[model samples]
Target: MARAQRPGSPPPGGLSVQDQAPGDRRRDSWKDSWGPARARLTDLAEDYARLLASQDPAAAEATGLPSRTLLPDVGPEALAERNRVERRLHQLVRAVETPRSLTGNHGAKDDDARDSTPGDGDPWGRAPLAVRVLRAHLLERLGTSIDLIESADQGAELNILTSPFQGVRRRLITLPTDLPGSTSSVQDWADLVDRYRAAPRALTGIRDSLAVSAAQGVLPPRGQVEAVARQTDDLARILASQARGDLSGGGHAAPGGALGRDLQVAANDAAQAVSDLGRYLRGELAPLTPVREGVGPSRHACWVRRMLGTSIDTAEVYQWARQELVDVVAAQDALAAEVLGTGSRAGDLDAHLRADPSTGMSPEDFPRWAQGVADEAWDAVVGRLLDVPDGLGRPTVLLDTPGGGVHYEEPEPSRSLSGRVLRSFAVGDETVWPWAERTTVLHESVPGHHTHSGAQSLDPSLTLWQRYLGKVPGCNEGWALYAERLAIETGLLSKPADRFGWLAARRWRIVRVLVDLGVHSWLPVPAEIAALPGAGGGTQWDRPTVEAALRAHTVLGEGFLQFEVDKQLGWPAQGLAYMLGERVWLAGRERAQHRAEEVRKKLDLRAFHNRGIGLGSVGLDLLIRELG
Candidate 1:
């Protein structure tokens, strides 16, 4: 009875399993039984993911699970349940990831070596072999998530003005699909009111948590406090402005129907509650807020780890960002010279192009116009540049309310084929400069998010857990950032404005790295950076200083700058993910191209792109290793 080689053990050299041929069965007898081990681990990994989604109704809805209710129960008990589930999950993941101390023999005389059946079905035939590798990949991701469950947005549990709570109000507006006259809409309106009435108690829980966090010196920065409070006020104002209107932003002047009267009553209560919550944040939470911007080195690492799924030295990242900003600005200046004259600065160029009504899309009509931008960008890219095997589906574009940032929601493959991109026209009375809007559409939809994320969701080779939990923001958003540049590289940026958009977007992202690193790592601001923003040099990296720098360097509008500054302060490392993620992606891509050049092989960029997408948000390090 020969023993099996433990799974994941390296060969004679330090070569990985990925380096070996799939048919190489030169192992002990227990190697034959390793199939059961692989099956059991992946089987449980898929199950745990569904169980995790079941606890949070928002998550359940987002991932296409059965939601117990329309609105999630945001109570202390719910929080406790979340913590328990995460810890248990962490333990389970660790169990699979850790190498077994000894190998088992699966000989005919060793029937005792057979521990147990993984499940009733031998999904061996149905499930892809890559799932085993993906499960190991998910271990790192789940470990990071488990940490985030304990840390990161603990502030959300205490603060009602935070994005997640605001999302409750925003999601209600989108969820009820039927018209205002339909019974479904009437029920939806009633549910909105129930959640609104529940807001006070839910908010008080957060208020208490903030108080607790405040005592621990965990207060959010002054800018974040101001931003959320302002957004909360906006919510209240919108409700009040549309007081006679229905939940879907339409006026129902003469409100008298079956549940319409109750709907009106509920709407009134929810509106009042939202207003009260805003008042609470401004009045009660403001004084306790810290004026300081940095969250210190210790917590910053946690943020980076949780956000990127890897640990990194913030000091190194900050240094890299500082250098990249200079390079990006130089390229932007060159593009500005080509598009506008050599003498034309980005700011003046932006002003000139947007001067006419025909030059740019109005921020107000962005939701209506973005559909075509996405459709056109995809038509230009796929087969021409990259491949989309399953064909494209238009993203469900939604107008994001206050606090909801621009993002893509991967549709639950179970419910529908299409994913959604949330475009925030948070800019009030502003213009989305011609090229900038197109690049973002590419980033958030079409060749960017929908292409990168949608492909993974549709990939039959992936497991349910892989699609749901495997997203590393660095990988996903990095691809999106890369996709923006792909538009220009592929000659898709035919318009001068489109070229400007590429430079403008890249410059903004570079600045984001600078601002985020500066905010979180206490990086020493240089004279070059001070000149970059053209806001006059400043040592302190506060809201005013950062805003001035953005104005000086990037072509982003004042409204967006304000939003960007507030988000950077509130979210910290997250703002940096676009550029930083792109940095990793570029490194991996460069590695592939350089290797291909060395071999004198024509590197099919499309194949390299597909390989990364197929991995479904595996960590950058693992992705790189596999790429090699």
Candidate 2:
């Protein structure tokens, strides 16, 4: 979708500071050839966005869910086609908007630049003719595509055509803190307020639209509307509190700082845009819609293509997830039985996991303990397990006292390529230790997301687009889960407590599959499934009737259930990524393992992983070839 820009035009989004390679002259030729096609693709994306905005008015009203479209159920081919369309859109944008221009004045500047950034893997290349033709159709429809989401009078809809994706551009900057020398931070409560002010107003519209849709009965019940409203309110309050120095210490919005605050504003705008656009689905635009049981396979495929940046049959992925769960659970159960005793049933193992005294560590020393665990894990990887990249700078692990889980934020492109793995301090029980600490380190730091992801981004051979933008969910999360298993192979799970912890983590993923299947596919959601005997009812949860509530809204759960339900409910396809990605990783690992005849050969696991990742954000089909 490369467009003709006035020569020396600033990059879209005021991101002018990031270093970028000059556009190749040969690429310009390809851009010229693809220009018409790219425009058509943009139209398709706009149409698809409108469809999403208006998907479910009744449900939106009842649950207050953002007026977003769900990915349609479809076969693989259609999904891939949709991806092509989006890729074209991104390519056109990138060709016109240089990355070097993304550095300043993100407020309005970034919005203008979003359509110009080549992203989601639609990089300039010598593509096939089919892609060229598809691009042409997309360009042809680009101008009128927005009409798909609107009524005769310009109302928005709730299908895959309208709400959430309407105003989407890859990166939304709410606060200005992302700029170097900016003092506003997500960590600072005051900066949070500033960021909210700058956030996109879409969310507010989304909330308001749902409320209206609910009252009109075009959306779901009041409960659903309330649920969404509550979420929106929570986000608003969180920003307000942080800004006012109520929840955390409020800090001044430093000069050139407050990007995080700005990001919040963008988030809000995204919400409002969704709601405003959702009006099409429940109101004037409903009559002309195609008749089906919700969005049919074709539409779902379109949605998947748009969201994932590739066309993937979500139903197929779900089937794969289901099978993987069966296999993983079966294998783990057998292992657990063997470890506990030959006669031990799952219940017995559960009892052991619950009653094991070693699992309990005092929470008061939690920060020191958590930091120590991260340090220990880091020690093993640095100059030992794998060659830590010298250019990665000094990696740091921090404890997040609130969220009680670990995640890593890689260094900004302007900063060193290092990363930070953070474990939330919110959950204070020592009972989560041994496994929690080990898995957190494995997943968040060494040999997991941070280490692998950081290195790849820093690799000089990779293009700026590939380095920073090549994030494939399957590869990223799948590799991390595989890394956890690798930790076990390296005896990282040596102690019983450690093993128990690993099992607990594994259980969490398994539960995600079950919950997603239960909620989305209309399967049964148990009130209480297998639990450790003395684990103190680890988070009482309401289990919905999956079949009865199919395409219906379910209340949020707490604890493990909370993660499972909330994620599955809010973001489709995310819950399945863990196991689905692990499946792909395990296949690659087994292949690599088979190739290495000697123990020493198999020992170079890092090499195998690096090879797999070097392929860049490709589909599973491409990954299979790369792994081979």
Candidate 3:
């Protein structure tokens, strides 16, 4: 996120001469505010997180489990808990807002203060950067959670799989290893068995909630319902395997003989619960689901806000996607011409590249292949592109999910374990090894998620709230998307084919942004790009149209394409987060770099990168406000 022409590295902390100027108020107050500001932020972060976790157990798992508690009952009970938390958040936000005044200056006499005394409304902005950002974060958190809950329609995101249930299931299974505080393996197994035993009862609450939601006319799209069923069915199989003594399912080795015997039986019961839920989703829920592919304006707006943490005009976003696609096409062509030489058909390059044997590794071989790629990506950027901290990424684990793509889990802030990439290298996506795997690796692992996420977890200056809860999609996903460009910029995409992979990777993002805007807003697909997806132009933004358009522009296989499409249907504007986030990050970098001279300062890439990541996990709006 930062770059400079410094002769060598500046210091141990990466602070420069300009940063430590004798009278530099910015640096001084930045130091001064660290204590009180951090304390307040930590309190805010912990309270908000605990409250949220009370409602959504998975959120707690993702945050280092300060309280190693299983989520309370699901369904309406959990929804009620969330409502209480939401109200509490509003009160907290009001309580913590820095009133319009300043007291003692923060660092130096002329330094920009953190906040003015309680009532003095001097023109200079009140509140420290951290406090302002924290307040905004609390607000953003409430918006995403409460708005989704408030807008509980049949198509709302409170369903069994993609909405919140799947996440809860994942956290529950991973608890023994993921939770802090080490217990003996036998004790851990017993604790896990207890949770396993409790799973069925816990699920009844969720199953009942789903029934009530359906009764109230709150249903999801039929296709999404089916997609979620596929996911639930997949998870059930994994649990069943674990119950039968396949340790891979639970990430726990069997204790053997009598001690492990009951583990298997308990796991069997858990698997039965999971399977029963899957049955409900497929046999009971799908028929009741609506067949519509798009959300109405109100729901769409909520999704946009939910994912991006900012609002944009949907009509403008659609046109922008179209224009962005045209540019992407041109850039790809230019790169292709450079790769293939003059008069060589650019589209042929794609055809030739797709035919490569390496693109079709069998599903059994994908974990090793993906793990190898993760290793290569880490080594490539560890020192060159990022100063990666110790104990970040581990050998990738191809965790079997319901329907899976590449997803990264950062090491918990506890540092007790290494980060593992869950690549549910599902078999349907042609050969699971698509060309974009490298870029995706970079996006999900080193120099992208692995490094960026590690920074978020490891930064000492960040409050626990910011650490556990602050990661907005825009700030983090934006960095990962920007990482793809960085890989290309650094000449990592050496071959024309590799460069094409980069293009294809980004091409899908552009397509996603367009599809999200189109499906939700029903923006009229422009004629210039109507045929843009494939041979015949697209007329409307529907499942087939978006799928064809994606296939036309990207190297994604059929199964992968379908997975992405169905997710887009259920998840809505979340598809836009990657590219939109990358755009913000890219622009923020340029904005800072370009304005460096105006501020009589030189940009520090390491500091810029470090600070950008260190701001914990706030949304892009706060990121731009602070970093810009």
Candidate 4:
């Protein structure tokens, strides 16, 4: 039989299959088969079920995650199969429940709880496409199912004020299946509880403020409000359910059944409290207020700050980022002349980037153009770039406009629509900056998330949690930012303007770190710092000085400023990931590169990167050690 070409390989006319050697042909045949050459995919469905039964049987029953058998090995074939089953599982789960976190203890404490914060330029936060899809499944299956029933607070538009004592209840129980050797120390749980309790007063205050704003004509849409309430009710229920289940010793089979029962009651109590507050908003506060469309960034920031545990001074952080921006812009200016024809106007860069017409071009093409540039970058880096694995699959670039940013969804199981790189289209009228788009692709696709996540799946030795759970934002995103800079240093951005894009992206991260630290840490925002460049010259800001500082430093134009500020306001510590992740990544790389030099061997950049990613998603502190 005539040998075939790799499926993704540029086809016959341009790259002849017959001309290829036998070894290449053999590999291409495997790629062409559309199934992994090694594993028996048939066994995957059963193994997956076994794993789930061992880990979380109740969640398995609720979502059917345990029904499928996943292949045992961590080979490419096994991963491919795992991907397929996980995707189906996700679809089934999302159909049952939305993953949007409602305002409750857990959701309120974590800044990254919002649905919009996924893949926000962080490699770790960027769940593998399989994981992202599966997490949606996990959320739907293991998370709260509030949409099925109305929450008691569903119709209430009031902010319930409760005594701090009412919210200070505590319980300690050893959880069954806390993952073999899971180290959730008593102190950690105690700290989590303490943090949860510390915020009631602040949460109540923010709720009341938002209500006041709403009464004065500034409230989020009714649907959004109801959504928040439902989310809140659902989260409380989930927490309560988990607790109850732990007490019952149900193991994985009755996942969160105990929590469900406990939260069922908690939800009712909270609803009544909210309802009473709603009455106060409409009756006592309505007459004295001015109506508005939604709670703005200021109010949202307050809530986010209370949730995430942060202590960075926002004003100082903003000043630092702004200063860095000046330096970055200056550097870009020097490079622009050499790349964009020496005299290209400042306004021309965006248009120049969008003008590239390449092989994968589409009508008013967005991602294809970006992908082409990224492809060129990869070509430059391959072999010479780093130690890229031969088996790593080529990424599939797709538009995800209408969503905030690019997302790296790992491939589905069964290899159907696998490795689809979903790029959220410029949702709404958010203009796509050519440089921003390409940088995003590099970070989310190339030597960034796509590579990191793929490595995790391929590394069988990693624990399930490392492979799939607890992807705290800081390390993941930080690595991506580092990767972007690494690509630039490696001369991947041959085009000067592309280099500028990388720098711009870096500036974006600097901003995120400063702001994230500011909000969660309760640092003050300086008025002078607030007066720096941003929306309304920072006049629109009325947040804690720290939050205001972060916003002013990270965001530029009015709209971006507003969007990021609001995002940070609603979700704390999330912004910190971009900065913190990058910092750790940069420092670690520096250490690696320095150590490699003293050893007098050509440092394998690819191996270093793969190792970092292969360690799995871990806490930033652990990440530093893993890299070392």
Each model's total of backbone clashes = 3, 118, 17, 71
**Global lDDT of each candidate:** 0.63, 0.45, 0.66, 0.46
lDDT of 1 by residue, 268-316 (tens): 6656766776676778777876677766566666678766766777778
CA lDDT for candidate 4: 0.46
lDDT of 3 by residue, 1-628 (tens): 2221112335336776566666654544444444454355557667777775655556666665544445445567667666677777667665653323234444423312334233465322454445555666777877677767655642245433366557547745664555545544877777777778777876766677777777777776677667666766777777788788886734455777876887788778878887787789788987787665677567787777767778777877777788888888887888767767775554867766667776666667766776776677667766665565445544354655536566877676355656666766544544654465677766777677877876566555455666666567777788889888877776666667777777877777888887777776667666654765452354556676777666776665577777677767667778889888888888888877886878788876666676576556777676676666
Q: What global local distance difference test value does model 2 have?
A: 0.45
Q: Pick the candidate with the highest TM-score.
A: 3
Task: Please provide TM-scores, in order, for all candidate models, with all chains considered together.
Answer: 0.77, 0.56, 0.78, 0.50
True lDDT of residue 154, candidate 4: 13
Model 2 lDDT tens row, 1-628:
1122322445444434343334433333333444454444444444444332334332332223344332221112322343455455545633442223223323222211222223334332123222322332233233122222121111212322123322221112233344335565445534333333323443444434433433433332222222343444444454444343333434334323454445445345544543443343345434433321122233333323323334455556546555655565565567667778676654466567668667656555555665666566667665555554456654566655465456787665554434777666445344554444677677777667766676665654333333443345656677778778877877766776576567656656755655554443433334333242222232222233322222121212245344433344433345555665677778866776775765456536656565565444444434553454
Q: Which of the two, 3 or 4, has more TM-score? A: 3
Best by lDDT: 3
> TM-score: which is higher, 1 or 2?
1
Q: What is the lDDT of residue 623 in candidate 1?
A: 60
Model 1: lDDT of residue 131? 37
